[model samples]
Target: MVPSDGTAGRPLRESIRDKLRERIIEGTYGPGDRIVERDVAADFGVSRLPVREALRMLDTEGFVEMLATRGVIVKKLSRRDVLELFDVREALEGLAFRRAAERLTKRDATHLGALRSKARKALEAADGPALHGFNEEFHDTVNRLARNDLLASILEPLEGRLHWIFRQNDRPDQLWREHEELLAAIVDRDGDRAADLAVAHVRVNRDRVLSHLFGDHPEGTAAAG
Candidate 1:
């Protein structure tokens, strides 16, 4: 039970929703965990109305499900669902990499390098949350460099889902290595190579996650038992 500070400028319900979402991302409320409205409201020192509204919004975002008997439960992604999401992410991110390669300047490359450095340090420290934040910053930088708002809009939700999946992953080293390679291709201004690397990078992550979820192998292992 984490109490909200009640200091944010947003509406009460929105703030509650954001807090719950953060908890979900931080694995405080993991997949299949029950989210009781009464518990959440009591935890946040709020009424059930706001809690219900927040849960409804989270449901629409695919973060939770409201079942007849289960009430509200945290959403869990199946292997097939994860693979399909990776397919979409791979396509969009590949395109983003191609465009970013064409538009990337020395300054942009330097900025991306800084992000990669931060991510690498986070990985070295074994800080999963920090690594996730830096990873988002890196991809967000690439998306912005692509200079296509529509593409960014389309990828935003998918990126959120990917973030959720990534939090469940245990291979920060592999992920950072892929990021390093992708950044290298982008810095070299090799659009084709960057695009290909981006696709392969996502596929590798997808496979690793699937192997963990459905197979006997440990998380982050490429082999499926």
Candidate 2:
């Protein structure tokens, strides 16, 4: 369902890249799913050159794997890979929350509150996509409030992967509740509490995903036992 010709101002290759990435994120192109260049090019009504260039960009971004024989497929993350990403996210987002708490403005607090409210409504309605979108907006707002471009650059890709994981888990209620708690801490300007909650939230999600992947005993607990 990628747009065929809506990219007026942007470069064709970049537009194609974004469309493909969006499809991948929204589960249209799932992990290990083949990305045929000809099909993509035809879908987008573009030449193969732009499609290939777009795929190369995605390959460099670790979204897809390119092979000589097998061609291109969506990159599949292992359990270890997800855990490692969670570890990084815990550290980075914990820092982001702390910093955001220190500099949280009334405007930012109001925006976050609105986002939380919207997310809650989405959750109540059982609208998964809307809830996910609002969840991202909430987190992205926090990242922006942190006001660190470098941190944003590092966290953005991780967030993308996390979104994919979240979609797979199918449990948005707890996540929305966590977002509510996080916003409360941020609004209170409690940096320490905010940071702790952020880390714990990441850990909670990590456990949820791992548990879903590995049955009743997650890899971490099984290893420790």
Candidate 3:
């Protein structure tokens, strides 16, 4: 079965868009690669209209670019783009962890505990894709525990690109360890420690991504965040 995309009843356009999005995220369709509509249509066994609509959604979400002359292609992330995104994430995520630590309900903690267990099992099983999804869910669960609607709304727009970065992580064990540390702080109800750990997590991931993309460049040049 094709997995549910959480798109509220699996509208055909959303389903197609999500499949294309997953391909792009997992590097099956890479940066700057053209996604021919007819080819995607054939692959999905559908007509071109849904493919076009899905491309439009992906375009708006900053996943791919729609072009009149060249068709659709995956969007490439500039170094500056990645760095600035991490900057925003550092601020927002730090706050989310702090608030969540301070205000965690028993139910919220239970949900987080379940997610943590699942993520750890996925890590142990060497399930890369499952761990990638769990990475996003981890952050989003913390944000939800924060119980701030304004913050949730702000974080919503950046989630797709953030998920893209999470998909870029080649070191899930390290990522899992970092998340475990942060989760530990939250469970201990140490708001300040949780906030510090969150900032450190974002910074290290930022450096890792920069190093991967631009090759051992120093702090200020490529990572100007």
Prediction RMSDs, each to the true structure:
3.9, 2.7, 2.9
lDDT of each: 0.80, 0.81, 0.84
* Residues 12-78 of candidate 1: C-alpha lDDT, one tens digit per residue: 7778887888888778998899999998888888889889998998998888999999999999876
- Regarding TM-score, does 1 or 3 come out ahead? 3
- Global CA lDDT of candidate 3, please? 0.84
Expressed as tens digits, the lDDT of each residue in 13-68 for candidate 3 is 88888889888888999999999989988888777787898899999988998777
Candidate 3 segments whose C-alpha is farther than 4 A from its true place: 1-11, 218-225
Single out the weakest 10-residue window by summed lDDT for candidate 1: 216-225
All candidates' TM-scores?
Answer: 0.85, 0.89, 0.87
On lDDT, who's better, 1 or 3?
A: 3
Q: List the residue pairs that clash in candidate 2.
A: none
For candidate 3, the clash count comes to 0
In model 1, the runs with Cα more than 4 Å from the true position are 1-9, 216-225
